[model samples]
Target chain A: MGSKEITYQQIYEENYPKVMRLCMGYTVGNESLAKDLAQETFIKVWQNLEGFRNESGLSTWIYRICVNTCLAEIRRERKKDKNLQIDNLQVSDSVDNATEKEDMLVQLYKCINKLSSTNKAIILLELEGLPQLEISEIMGIKHEAIRTRIHRIKQQLTKCVHNE
Target chain B: MNNFEDLQNKWQNQTTISATEDGFQSLLKSVKFIEQKQRTGNIVLTITIVILVAFLLYVSGYKSATFMLGIGLMICSLVVRIAVELYSLKKLRTINFSKESNTFRSDLTSYYSFRKYTHYVVTPLAVGIYTVGFIILLPLFKATLSNGFYTYIQCSSVVFLMVFSVFLYKQAKSELLKLKQLQLED
Candidate 1:
C-alpha cells in the first residue's frame, strides 16, 4: 500500500476501537447511537486530516474531534427531543460480568449522563488512558487545570456511583 | 467500597464498541457534499451581490467617490471572509481528537465565541453601514422616501435590529453558561 493508504489503515485500526468507546460514553452506552457517533467522529477526522499538522499527537487530535462531534450530536438531539434530560439517562458501568454488571453499568452511566458535555469528554479520555498533558493540549486548557478536573471528576464519580 | 480505584477498574474493562461501515461511509460523503455546497453557494452569493451593486450604482449615478467607497466595503467584506476561513482552517488543524482536557474545552469555547461574535456583531454592523450607503445613493437617483416613510423605516429597522441583537446576546449567554456547567462538572 502507498504511504497515505498505510496511514489511513493505521489510523482506522488504532483509533477506531477507542473512538467507539468514547462515543459509547457520550451516548450513555446506547449501542446504535454510539456507533453512529463513532462513525461521525471518524468522518470528521478524515475530512480535517489535511489541517492536521504535528502540533499535537494524532490520537489527541482525533479525540478532540470526536468529543466535539459527540457534543454537537447531543445538542442537535436535544433540539429534537426537548423532553430528554441528560441527567436521567442511565449509565452502564458493567465490565466483564453479565447480570449484575449490567445494573451497575446502568447506574454508572446515569451519573455520567448528568455530567456536562465537556466533563463527560474529559472523563472518557482519561478513562481511555490518555496522558494529562495530551488531554490539556487537545482541550486547549492549562496542564494544571486538566489535573484538577481529573481529580474532581474522580471524586464526583465516586459520589455518584455510591449514591446509585 | 465506593472508592475511585474501584470505579476506575470497572470503567477500564468496559465493553468495546465499533462503528458501522455504512454510517462512517455516509458521514464522509455528507461532509464532502456540504463543503462543496458551501463553496458553490458563496461564489454565487458574491456574484449576485456584485451584479446588484453594479446595477444600483448605474441607476443612482452616484459620484465616482461614493461608488468607489461601496466597492471598497465589498472588497473588505471579502477579505474578512477569507481571513475567517483561514483562521477556522488553522483551528481545525490544531484540534486534538484523542486527549480530553479542560483546556481543549476552553479553546473550543473560545473558538465558538469568536465565530458567534463575528456573525452576530460584525454582520449587523456591516449591514448598518450598507444601509447608510444605500440611503446616500438613493438621493442621488431622485428616489428619496417621504419624510414620514423614511422615519418609519429607520425606526422599524432599529427596533428589529435591537430585538435581533438581544436574541443573539441571550443565545451567546446560554451557550457560555452551558460551557461553564460542563467545566464545573469536571
Candidate 2:
C-alpha cells in the first residue's frame, strides 16, 4: 500500500468509534443511520485527504466533516418524511432487545433531538467530551456562547430525560 | 442519567464498536469508485458543452438570416443554461465542509437559494427561448431537407422537448423541497 493509504487506514480505525458516537447522537440513537453517517464522513475525509492542510487538529477536521454530513442528512430527512424522526426514536431494527442502559441512551437522544439543529450539533460534540473551545471551533460560535449553550443544553437534557 | 457527570461517565464507558477489516477494505473500494464517478461526470459535461458550442459554430456558416436568428437564439439559451450549471458547480466546490456548522449552513443556504432562483426563473426562460428557436428553424429544415427527413426532425424535436420539460419540472420540484429543508428554525 502507498503511504497515503496506510495513513488513512490508521486515521479511520482511530476515529471510527468517535465518529459513530457523534453520529448516533445526531441520528437519535439509530445505530444503522449512525453507521451510515459515520461511513459517509469517512468517505469525505478520504476524498479530501489531499487538501488536509494541518491548520487544525486532525480530529477537529474529521468532526467538522461529520457534523456537516449529519446536518445535511437532517435536512434531507426533514423534507423527505416527518415520520422518520419518530421511526428513528424507536429501538433500531438491529438491536433485538434493548437493555435499560440502551433505553436511557434512547431517551437521552430523544431529548437531544428536541434542540434546534445547531444546538443538537453543539451538545453532541459536548457529549463526545470535546472541549468547550473545540465545540466553539466546530460550531463557529464564540467560546463564551458555546459554554452558555452547553449549560442550557445540559439542563434541558437533564429535565427531558427525567421526564421520560 | 440525571446528573450530567454520570451521563458523561456512561457515555465514556459505552463499548466502542471496533472496525472490521472487511468493512475497511470495502470502504476503500467505494472511495475509489466515487472518485472515478465524479471524474467521469465532469468529463461528460465538458464534452457535451464543447459539442453543443461546436454545432452552433458549424451552423453559423449557413448565412441565412432566419437560420442565424434561430441558431443564435438556441446558442444563447444553451449558453445561459451552461453558465448557470457551471456557476452552481463552482459554488458547491467553494463550500468548505471543514468549516464550522453555522458558516457551512450559510454557504449551503446561499447555494440552494441560487438554485431556487435558477429553477424558478432562469431555467424556464432558457427552455422557452430554446424551444422557440428550434421551432423557428423548422421551416428552414422543411425547405432544405427531404419531406421524410423533415417529418422525422419534427417528431424527434417534440419528443425531446417533452422529455426535457419533464426533467426540468422534476429538478425544480426537488430544488424547492431542498430549499424548504434549509429553512432551519433557530
Candidate 3:
C-alpha cells in the first residue's frame, strides 16, 4: 500500500477511538449517535487530509472538525423541526452504591449540556486531556482566551455539579 | 473531596464510551459517502471551469463574450452551490432528532457533513473562484493589472477574509461554550 493509504490507516486506528469518545461526550453517551458522528468526523479528516496545511497540529484540526461537525448537526436539527426536543435525556439521578459512577456520568452530561456550545467544547476538550494551546487552535481562539474560558467553565461546572 | 477539583476529578473518573466495531464501521461508511460526494462535486466544478475558460479564450475579442462568460461562470457556481446546499438540506430533513437515542447522533452526522462541505469544500473553492474571476475580469475590463491595484485588492481581501473567518470562528466557539454551560445547568 502507498504511504497515503498507510497514513490513512494509522490515522483511523489511532484517532478513531478518541474521536468516538469525544463524540460520545458531545452526544451524551448515545452510543449509536456517537459512533455515527465519530465516523463522519474521520471521513472528513480523511477527505481534507491533503489540505491539512500543518499550521495547526493534526489532532487540533481533527478536534476542530469534530466540534464543528457536532455543532452543525445541532444547528441543522434546530432548523428542521423547530419543536424537536431531546427526550428522556438521562440526567444524573440520586447517587447509589451500585450506580454511583454511572450517576456521575449522567450528571456530568447534564451539567455539560447546561454549558454554551463553546464552553462545552472547551470543557470537553479539557477533560479529554488536550493542552491549552491545542484547545485554542482547535477553538480558533487565543490561548489566553481558552485559559480564561476554561477557568470560568470549571467554576460554573463546579457550582452545577455541587448543587446536583 | 467536596471542592470543585474533587468534583471535576470525579467527573473525569467516569468511564468513556468503549471502542467497538460498530462504531468503526459507521465511521468508515460515512467517510466513504462524503468522499464520493466530494468527488462528484469536484468533477462538476472542474467541468464548469473548463467550459468557462474555453468560452473566455474563444471570445477574447468580443466584449459581449467576456460578459457572457463571466455571467455564465457566476451562474454555474451559484447553481452548484445551491445544489450542494439543497443536497445537505435534504439529507438533514431525513433525520428525526426527537426520536430515541440515536436520532440526535444522526442529525449531528448530517450537520457535520454540511459543515465539512461549507468549510473544507465550498468556502475555499468560492474564494479561489472569486479570485480567478477578479483576475480574469481585470484584464478584460480594461483595468490596469500592473499599477499595484491588483496587489492591493488581493492583500486587502486576504486580510478581510482572515479577520472575518477568525471573528466568525470565535463567535461560534463562544456559542458552543454557552451551550455546554446550559447543558450543565441543574
Candidate 4:
C-alpha cells in the first residue's frame, strides 16, 4: 500500500532502450515493429501505473507489459482475416552485403524468432543481462525452469543459426 | 558462437528512439475515448433497461395483453444489448499482458473472434428483434392517437430507424472486412 509513485516520463526515458531491444528479439530484429511494440508497452505501462502495487521490481512489471504487447500484436495479426495480410505485416530484415559477423547476427535473429515465446523472453532477457531470478519473476515461472530453459534455448538457437 | 559479449554489447549500446510526448498524448486520447465509449454505452443501456422496467410497471396496470407483449419485447431487446456489452467487457478484461506470447496470442485471438461474433451475429439479431417489436407496437399506440398523428409518427420513426439500422449494418460489415484485411504476414 505504499505510494512510491514514479512518473511515466521517467519510466519511459529510463527503460525505452531495453524494452526496444527486447521487442526486437520478438520481432526478428525488425526495428520498426520493435519501436511500435515499445511504444505500445509504454502506453500500457502509463495506463496501468496507478494500479501497480509496488510488490516487485519495476522492470519486471514493465517487461511483463512489453511481452504482453508483443503477444497482442501477434495475436491480433493471427486473428485478422487472411486476405489482407500483406500490409506492413512483414518486418524487413533488410541487410545489404553484410560481413560475417552481421550475417551471424541476422541468423541469430532468425533463430530467435523460431523459439517459443516463453523461451524467446528467457533468452533475450538472458542476453540483456537481466538476472535469471528477475526473468523468472517477470515470466511467472519457476527459477529452475528458467535456468533449465535458458540452457535448452541456447542449444536450440545455436543449432538453428547453424541450420543444423 | 558461444561468445555473447558481442551480442550483449550490441544490445546495451543500442541507440533507440522513445515515444514522444505527442505520441503519448494521442495514445492517451485514444485510450480515454475507448473507456468513455464503454462507460457511455453501459450508462445508456442501463438507463434504457430501467425506463423499460418503469414503463412496464405502468403498462401492466392497464391490463392489455397486446400492450404488455409489446413492452415485453422492448425489455427483451434492452436485455440483449446489455448481454452483448457484458460479453465484450469480459473478453477485454481477460486480455493478459503477462502470459507467454503464444498463450497470449491464443487468448487474444479468441477474444477477437468473439468480438466478431458479437458484431456480426448478436447485435444484428437484437436489432432485428427491436425492429419487429417496434412495428408490432404501432397498433397499440394507434388505440390512443388520431389517424393523422399516428401515421406521421409511425412513418417518421420507422423510416428513420430503418435507415439508421441499414447504415449501422453496412458500417459494421465494412469494419469486419477491414479487420479481416489486417492479417499479418509471418
Candidate 5:
C-alpha cells in the first residue's frame, strides 16, 4: 500500500471506536445516527488527511472533526423541522430490552442531550477520558474553563440520571 | 446513587461497534464518490457557460449594440454566479476542522454570513439582470420570427421565468434557514 493509505488505515483503526462513542453521546444513544455521524467524520478525515499538520495529536484532531460533524447535523435537522425534538423517549421505551448497565448508559445520554450543543461536546470528551488540557485545546477554550465546566456538568448529569 | 467514577467505569466498558477491514475499503470508494460529485457540479456549470458563450459568438451578437448588451448581461450573470459558487466551495475547504471548537464555529459563522449575503443580495440581483436581458431580446425575437413562433416564445419565456423564480426562492429560503440555525448556536 501507498504511504497515505497505510497512514489512513492506522488512523481509522485507532480512532473509530472513540469517534463512535463521542457521536453516540451527541446523538443521545441513537446508535444509527451515531454510526452515520462517525462515518461522516471519517469521510471528512479522509478528505482532509493531506491538509493535516502535526500541530496537535492526531486523535485530538479527530475528536475536533467528530464534534463539528455532530453539531452540523443539528443544523441540518433544524432546517427540516424547526421544532423537532430529539425523541429521547425512544431510549426509555426500549429500556425493558436493555441490561441494567445499558439502561444507565441510556440515561447518561439523555442527560447529555439536555445541555447545550457545546456542553454536550465538552462532557462527552471528558467522559471519554481525555485530559482537560486536551479537551480545552480541542474546544479552543481555556484549560480552567474546561475544568470548571466538566465539574458542573458532572453534577448536573448525575442528578439527571438519578431523577430518571 | 451512582457516583461519577462508577458512571465513568460504565462508559469505559461500553460496547462499541467494531470497525471492520471492509469499512475502510468502502470509505475509500465513498471518498471518490464525494470528489466526483463536487467535480460534476462544477463541470455542469462550466459547460453551460461555454455553450452560452459559443452560441453568442456564432450569432455574432456583437453586431448590434442592443443584442450585445442583452447577451452580455446574461452571460455576465452566469459567469458571476459560477464564480461565487466556486469561491464559496474554496472557502469551505479552507476551514480547518482540527481547530478548537470556538474557532471552528467562528469560521463557520463567517461562511454562513457570506452565504446569507449571496442569497439575499447577489442572487436576486443576478436573476433580475438575467430577466431584464431576456426582456431586451424579446422585441428582436418578435420582429424576426413568424407570429406563431413569437407567441410561443413569449408564452414559454414567461412560464420559464415563473418556474425559475419559484425554484430560486425555495432554494434561497432553505439555505438561509440552515445558515440561521448555525449562527444561533452557542
Candidate 6:
C-alpha cells in the first residue's frame, strides 16, 4: 500500500485499541457499544482527515474525536433510557473463581463509568499515560484545572471502587 | 478497598480490544456510506433550491397578485430553511473536535436547539407555501388539464406538504431531546 493510500489505514490500525479502550471506559465495558462508538469515531477521523491542520497532534485530534463520539452515543443512549453506563454493564464483583486482580479490574471500570464524561476522558487519558499538559490541551481546559480535576476524579474513583 | 494507585494499575492492565480485519473493512465501508449519504442530501437540497429560484424567476413576469404572493412566501420560506441548515452545517464544520469535552457538549446542544427552532417555525411556513405555491399554478394546470386533475394535484400537494412537515418536526424533536438528555446528564 502506498503511503498516500494507507495513511488512514495506518492511523486506524495504531489508534484503534486506544480509541476502543477510551470508549470501553466511557461506556463502562458495554463492549458492543464501545465497538460501535469506536467505529463511529474512526469513520469521523477518516472523513475529516483532509481538514486536519496538524495544529493539534494527530493522536490528540483522534482522542478528542473519540471523546466526543462516545459522549454523543452515551447521550443518545440516555435519551432512550438505555441504562448504558452502570445498569446494563456485565460488571461482576464476585472473584470467587476469578483472580483478585481480575475482580478489581471490573470494579475499576465500574467506578470509571460512575464518573462524569469529562472525567472519564481525563482519567482514561491519564491512565493511558498521556501527560497532564496534553490531557489539558485535548480537553480545552487549563493545565492546572486538569491537575486538580485528575486529583479529584481519582478520589471519586477510589471511593466508588471501594463502595465507600 | 482498591485505592487510586491500585485502580490505576488495574486500569492500565485491562485488556485492549483490537478490531478484527473484517471489522476494519466494514468500518471503512460504513464511512464511505455515511459520506455518500450526506453528500446526497446536500446535493438534493441545493438542487431543489436552485430549481425553485429559477422557477420563481420564470413565474415573476406573469404579474398575477396571488401568484406573486405565493412565490414570495415560498422564496422566503426556502431561504430561511436553507439558511438554518447552512448555519448548522457551518457550526459543525468549524467545531474543534479536539477541544474541551464541555465545549463539544455545549456546541452540540446549541446546534440542536437552533435546528429545533428552524424546524418548528419554518416547516409549517414551508407547508403553507407549498400548498399555496401549487395552487398558484392552478391556472396553468387548468389550461392543460381537466378540473378533476387539477383538484387531484392540489389535494396531493397538500397531503405531501403535511407529511413532509410532520417528518421534519419529529426529526427535530428527536434530535433536540437527545441533546437535552446529554446536557442534563452533564
Q: Which of the numbered candidates is closest to the native, going by highest DockQ?
A: 5
**TM-score for all models, in order of appearance:** 0.62, 0.86, 0.53, 0.63, 0.87, 0.79
How far residue B78's Cα lies from its native spot in candidate 3, in Å, is 12
Give the per-residue lDDT of model 3 (tens digit) for B16-45.
455456655555666677778967977996
Q: What is the DockQ of each candidate?
A: 0.37, 0.50, 0.11, 0.22, 0.52, 0.49
Worst 10 residues of 5 chain A by lDDT: A84-93
Off by over 4 Å in 6: A51-56, A80-106, B35-46, B57-63, B120-162, B178-186
Q: How close is candidate 6 to the true structure, as a TM-score?
A: 0.79
lDDT, residue B15, model 1: 58
Tens digit per residue, CA lDDT, model 5, A8-104: 8899988998998898777666677777888899988988898898889998999999998887676655332333233432222234544677668
The alpha-carbon RMSD over the true interface for every model, in angstroms, is: 4.7, 3.4, 10.1, 6.5, 3.6, 3.3
Tens-place lDDT digits, model 6, residues A13-95: 88998998888887777777788889889887877788888988899899989988887777666433235443333323455
Write one digit per residue (lDDT tens) for candidate 1, span A97-136.
Answer: 4545555666667788778777787887787778888777
Name the DockQ score for candidate 3. 0.11
Give the TM-score of chain B in candidate 4: 0.66
lDDT of each: 0.67, 0.81, 0.63, 0.68, 0.81, 0.76
lDDT, candidate 6, B1-186, per-residue tens: 467776666666666776577877787779778879988988998898789879878987886786677667767766776777777888877765556677887887787777777667766776677567666767877788898998898788778777876888788777888766766664
Residues B4-114, model 1: lDDT tens digits: 666565666665644355544565567668779879977986996788667666746655676557545655554565566567667754655443444555666666666
Cα deviation of A85 in candidate 5 (Å)? 12
Candidate closer to the true structure by TM-score (higher is better), 4 or 6: 6
- In model 1, what lDDT does residue A110 have? 70
Q: Write the per-residue lDDT of candidate 4 for residues B1-186, one digit (tens) a residue.
A: 444555555445444455576755665566567679878988987897788778777877977777767767767886887777787778777676755444555666566677778777877887778777777789877998899999998889878878978987785665465345333311
In candidate 3, chain A reaches a TM of 0.83
Considering summed lDDT, which 10 consecutive residues are worst modelled in model 6 chain B?
B93-102
Top-scoring candidate (TM-score) = 5
Tens digits of per-residue lDDT for model 2, B1-186: 369775665566566566877878988998999889989988998998789878977986786999898888898998999889889988987788888888998888888899999998899999999988998999999999999999999999889999999998998887677677678457
Deviating ranges (above 4 Å) for candidate 4: A1-6, A29-33, A79-102, B2-15, B19-71, B74-78, B87-91, B94-186
TM-score of 2: 0.86
